[model samples]
Target: MTPFRLGVLVNPLAGLGGSVALKGSDDVAEQALALGAEPKAQQRMLQALSLCRPHFNNIEFKTASGSMGADLLEQLGVTAQVLHQLEPEAVTTADDTTAAAAALLDSGVDLLLFAGGDGTARDICSLLEARGRSDRQVVLGVPAGVKIHSGVYGITPKASGEVVALMAQGELVSSMMAEVRDIDEVAFRQGQVRAKHYGEMRIPEALKFVQAVKMGGQEIKELVLDDICAEFIERMDSDCQYIMGSGSTVAAVMAELGFDNTLLGVDLIDCDGVIASDLTASQLLEQIDHRPTKLVVTLIGGQGHLFGRGNQQLSPQLLRHLGADNIIILATKSKLEALEGRPMISDTGDPELDVALAGWYPIITGYHDEVLYPLQ
Candidate 1:
């Protein structure tokens, strides 16, 4: 079997500055003191290394220096083949990120896996777009920042580890969305919550999903869409597994099914009930294949992304398990109106897969009320 090339990038300063900023302490030491964060970027990198290292005996982990990208790989008992970075004074910003990522993409790696927040993801995504390398090749994200907009992440660092473990096995995964919860930092500092769209990234959306947090000043009803989704899920065949997607809408399926859900996170469900706690693509597929199954999902409130936003746990293998026909979308009239002609955005970064999901899909609003909305 041909070996797959994996690229690793670490923004040692990813959450470093977030601690001082009102965005919450993205800095590990400061976040550890604040008790909200676990100083996770480094730990997450080590975890990904542990998972990826054992699988790729002939593989090389190329990175940048000084915890910027390649340095962290060295700490993980891995060696960096090339050095690409600038002075520390010039390294604090994400500007070096795009150039460094471009360098890796040029190396012809099969995949690139990096650890950082949404800012890092946007830089990489933009770089990939600029280089026209965002197609075919895949990228995975290790959660390490205050906010992650790239749909290419799992619900947690460990879950990200699990994804790399399976992907290294050369398994197929589904494209997912990465949503960086938009927040008005200036207004937030003034004691107001103003959250809006930051950007989107494409990753593998897993059954165990991360729910998009309702940004500041938003009074979103967690139940409106639930009421609608539950009505439809109740009609599903209990013998068939139901691969539920992320969002409060799909959470209603769990509520109606008599199971607990992580309101703003993703969960897996089927005839047996909740399959697992936040599954990546590979995990979901290992459970859903060969069994009659369907997927129940919903669109993002304002952005209206049906797939690949805030749902990185999904892998390509999972999407094939349920097939597109088995997928269900639940949305409220208000949520639909919020889109206002903006096409349902998908940044799973797979152009062919993105086009495959394009078409008019059936959206169930409430019991007995449904509409065919275009996913394009």
Candidate 2:
């Protein structure tokens, strides 16, 4: 078997800003730093390179000039020849990214490993299509973005590392369809949520996540999650007050329990989905005069995130009470591969809180059957 000739490209500007802070990344640079999105692209890029180093000892590592991909590799001790870069300390733009990717293809690399989110994916896709070399080039993603809606990325850094190692081994892997999705930052800043699909690529599924399929049937879609949740609610078995996180799935349980639940808001429920307090985090703790409450949640379709992104009320205190074991994840087969391997992401306003829920956890996508999905 031929050991792979891999091309490494790092977008040092990626995830430079995000919604981790009280405020998300601003359209301008001044706004990015205010929200704690410093120029950590270099840091994240180095991390990905550090992970790549162990696999190839004498491989040719091609990168653009500057922090785009060159400096990051240099810092990680990758003594490969530089590509078409002019500076090592500067940052690379999307223009530089596409050009360098095309250069790497002409030089004959086995796979092109890129570090960034969906935006970076779009650039790579453009280059591949321009060169008519999409099929010849293999790609992988290192997750370091705010909204990465691509199946080319692994669920987490660790999972991504694992996928790359397997690829280096020359195993029979399949190229998953990596789609291009970008949120309209301008509109989003103006409180309008707009996401557009740019394109698709077939990368190795062993690396990234698939979007969950959307459940159907007004009757059945409404019934499965609700019925399952209702049975679990009835079995709460203790006065351990409950917190009802919002969603139509959770609403099903409330429907069975004869309680009117807010479909989009977090609700505090009894062990039986009875809304005791549809309050905020502070209000939730106030209403719970008991111990050991459980948090019921379901995976999001197309993203697979359970807590951090949608429900903001499952705070650290709430998780401590619900416990990891008590955190229930529900999804249907239809929505399991929405983005392929990208685990459901949670952006619950805290980066530390978000990473705390990292690692793989058991998800009940069906009755009595569970799949271990990454939650980082």
Candidate 3:
């Protein structure tokens, strides 16, 4: 079989803002660096390169120079044709990303493997559209950014590698147009999520590896939320501490109990009222220490993600402590149908925890109604 030319690019500073609670690293890379944040995109790209190293002979890698892409591939002992020459600096900008993408496109690569979040995706998407190469070339994203609402990204770095391997072997993988969504960093930092579709790209589809585009909660019904709220109240156990997950759907449940809720942050509640609002990961663990606690959450509409998207406050450690059985999932029928029979996903960065959280879980649809949905 003929070797497939793969273009590799890393944003270098992608996901630098997540650990420091910066929401996104779009224009705040310097702040994240000042806060002692480390570069994760290169490490994640290394993970992908490591997984695909065995098939190196079947793939010809085309990458940017320095910390952008070729450096990581070189560490893995894979020789790649360096396309763009980036200046040696402590930081790289959006221009570097666009230039690398343009050079990769000009090199006639079959697939472009990128490491970053929505902003990086937007940069590449714009380059593809401007060059009119979106239809001819396939793109895949390694999930290394903070705000990744794009459907072009794989669920994880390892998943991205596996999909690339499949394509390199000329496997019968499908392709489709996925949305590239980005949010305002300023608004996102203030805990207000304002995501917009920047563009779309044709990406290789791997059912278990690629992620779905996040859906907006614009089609919400007040009555359905009211019914779900009433249902949850009826089943509340006064003795068990209930931790409310983030999202408008979970916020609705809190509204029914006549308590002020954190619309986009984690809150802990009980039969009495709200115990804590806008708690952190450490605070969540402290509040639920050695006590019988349950978590209430809802799925992202089109994405079908149960965790690791907007609510990173629900740490993997916390999820392991709470266990899957003690968790309650709420979603409207319209939201569930939006998935078109796709299982919900979780990328908590813990493979063991992700596996444990997998399988079918009962999702409360409305008053006295439930459906078994697979959590993958």
Candidate 4:
């Protein structure tokens, strides 16, 4: 039997800055390392590849040399043909990522599995665009970076592996074009978010594993927002801590309460006012303090994801603490209808929590208006 051609690439320095609170690992990899940050891209790659062990004989691996790809495969006792070689003792860079992607494309792999953040996704997507092969090449991203606004990535490392495993088993997984987006690291560090679209790449459409491109901008329904906000504000308890999630729908609620909103990041608020703006995952967990906290979130339009799109700050630990009943979901009726009956997804990177979060819940659509929506 012919084996599935699997191309693998890893950005060795992808998420180094995330642990040390640098916001992103674009050009500040050295500074991140200076802060005692350890490399995690290869470890994340290991998580994905480990799950593919059972189907090893049915898959042919191709990758770049060293930490870029071959090193991790070697560690797993899997042999891969090194199509691109990096200079010995040289630090990996974005150029290396692109060059390695070019080599993989030239080798004609069925799917290219890349482990990195949005920046890495942009490198590979840009190369495909430059070669006019965006439609032809199928790529998948394993989330190992601080900034993961792109839609090409799997919800988690294990989820990405599961998708590849399906292909290895000869399952008919369809492909779809997912957007590639990145935020300016400088602005992000300064507490301002400026996400811009780079391009799109074709990825396996396994909705249970892959996330959707974040819907940007404000909702068009002005009066419906007013009604929704009115209903939410009426129910807001002054004693409870509210974790305001990212997105315009949630921003509308903040605006109604006369509090400053982080349009693309998490914010902490209460009846008193904005407690903190633009918090990291650790900062958010610190502030909860076992207080009666509720999370105000909106689904990613067209995708119907309640968690794990742009709100990674709501880490699984925090979600479990807040409990599922404390979550307040806000979305327009049109947005829910657009899903065409697909259930809302919660790819929180914790399979157990995702299952716990599933069930029917009332979604605030307008004043005294709600529809029972299923979150899976």
Stretches > 4 Å off in candidate 4: 207-376
- Give the root-mean-square deviation of each candidate in angstroms: 17.6, 20.6, 20.8, 19.8
Candidate 4 lDDT, 38-81, residue by residue in tens? 99999998998888899999788999999999999999999899
Return model 1's CA RMSD, one decimal. 17.6
lDDT tens digits, residue span 1-376, model 1? 2334567777665665455554633224344446553345777778766766667664556666666666566666666666476676553456667767777766655457788876677678777666554533467788887765446676777787777665455333334344545344456557777665545544543332122333323354554555576568667787776667777767766777788786655566666677776766667767775577777778888877777777766655566445556777787756665676444565566766665665434466555444434565
lDDT of each: 0.62, 0.62, 0.83, 0.85
Model 3 per-residue lDDT tens digits across residues 137-248: 5789999998789999998899988988776654434556789999998987787889898888978766432212223454447777777788888989988889898888
Clashes of 1: 39
TM-score of each: 0.48, 0.50, 0.55, 0.56
Residue ranges of candidate 1 with Cα displaced over 4 Å? 17-21, 24-40, 88-91, 133-136, 177-181, 205-376
Candidate 3, after superposition: displacement of residue 332 in Å? Answer: 39
Which pairs in model 4 have colliding backbones?
none
Count of steric clashes across candidates, in order: 39, 30, 0, 0
Highest TM-score among the candidates is held by which one? 4
Task: For model 1, state the Cα shift of residue 288 in Å.
Answer: 41
Q: Sort by TM-score, best first: what order?
A: 4, 3, 2, 1
Model 4, C-alpha of 191: deviation from truth (Å): 0.5
User: In candidate 3, which residue pairs clash?
Assistant: none
Ranking by lDDT: 4, 3, 2, 1
Writing each residue's lDDT as its tens digit, candidate 2 over 178-213 gives 676777777766778787877666565452322232
